[model samples]
Target: MLSWVDGRPAELLSVRDRGLAYGDGLFETVAVRGGRPALLERHLARLAEGCARLGLPYDATVLRDELLAFSRQLGEGVAKLILTRGDGLRGYAPPQPAVVRRLLLGGARPAYPAEHAEQGVRLFPCATRLAEQPLLAGLKHLNRLEQVLARSEWQDDEHAEGLMQDASGRVIEGVFSNLFLLKGGVLLTPDLSRCGVAGVMRAELLAQADALGVPCEVRDIDLAELLSADEVFLCNSLYGVWPVRRLQGRDWPVGPLTRKLQAIARDLLDC
Candidate 1:
């Protein structure tokens, strides 16, 4: 494993970095194989977009070169890229000519259990509700307290992930991944315009579904709809796709459509 901070090789994060002090940054977790960052283009695009949204400077080409060089050191693993606003003044006010800090941490190979992927995973509804913040939604920002709190609600190792809802009790997504449900032959995923990170894998799946002529919807989802879903799944760039076997005592089949998605994901990730 290897790590670099602020364009220099380092092992420990500075306590004064704005990312640690104020969560003032953005990050992307990418799967690196054979020294290549998977979906590098998409990740860079998202990083640039996040920086623009936060009024930060981001040169994608430079960052790309840095990431390539960093990943080459790891051989194969997960590459976590973080861009922070740097050490700031004592308050929330923005600093003039902010010093941006870039960090690349390595070593996170896919280690999900085979049984969970083959038979599917079990989930439970988390009492935590994601806050509605359109400005921050869809960006993989540093403010992830909601996910941390929701994930902490469960201690059972058998439960792979927990489902979170919006403030209005509308089903949103899993703690660290996107949620998809198949109900009555329709593919439904939460509209992340209001909240939740717009996962790269989820976007790819949606595009695939569109090309394959599968009926798909992006809108508000209710818990009752999820409870009645014929099948459910969670996805992120790292884990690929995982079928949900159970959710709060509700059982689901690893149906044909879910398998089709899995096949596409495998091809995309070269797994």
Candidate 2:
């Protein structure tokens, strides 16, 4: 494990930091290969958007340099970038003239079972439902208690991921990955405008689908739509793509489209 705080090496954070105090921060989990961060531009773009949405001051150039340096030092692994509103006085109100803080942590790449990507995975149906908050939607903010609770609903190895839905039973995503389904030759994913994390890999796949003339749609997906799909898969920046074979007793074969997009995701992460 390695860590950096504001471009300098450190292992501790201020207790008064708003990120710790009130979850006033955004984070990016990046995959590094050969001393470079995969999907660098997309990660930076999301960070920029999050900073603007949260009214935090940021220097994209500085952050980029720090990320590059951190990844180079890490060599090959997963790098997590955390951007916070720095320390603040005791209150819910954000401090004026906030000084942003950047924290980078690196860890070894996860050794996920190859069968997950090769054969496919089963999903645990989580009872915890996501609350709709358009204001905070799609931003990978520090507040992730919802995900924590949902993930805890499962305590076995049969399921590789948990299926999460919004309060209205609309399928949104997996616990730690974005969800996509293929139906009638169309690649469909849940819209993050109302809730859910807008993953970098999801955006990349949608772009690739468009380039390859694969019909792609971003809209609300209900359980029925997902269950009746021709194929299903999950994606995140870390593991690329995992074809979903089972969910709540329903089974789906790893279809051709899933394979095609999975290959694309693998190539993107590899490069």
lDDT of each: 0.88, 0.95
- Taking all chains together, the TM-score of candidate 2 against the true structure is 0.99
Candidate 2: give the clashing pairs.
Answer: none
lDDT (Cα, tens digit) per residue for candidate 1, span 8-105: 79988767788888899999998888888887888898898899999888888789999988877887889999999987778888788888889999
lDDT of 2 by residue, 80-127 (tens): 999999999998888899999999999999999999999999999999
Best-matching candidate per lDDT: 2
- TM agreement with the true structure for every prediction: 0.96, 0.99
CA RMSD per model (angstroms)? 1.4, 0.6
Worst ten-residue run, lDDT, model 1?
A: 262-271
* Model 1 lDDT on a 0 to 1 scale: 0.88
Q: Which candidate should be chosen as best, given TM-score against the real structure?
A: 2
lDDT of 2 at 177: 97
Evaluated at residue 76, the lDDT of candidate 1 is: 85
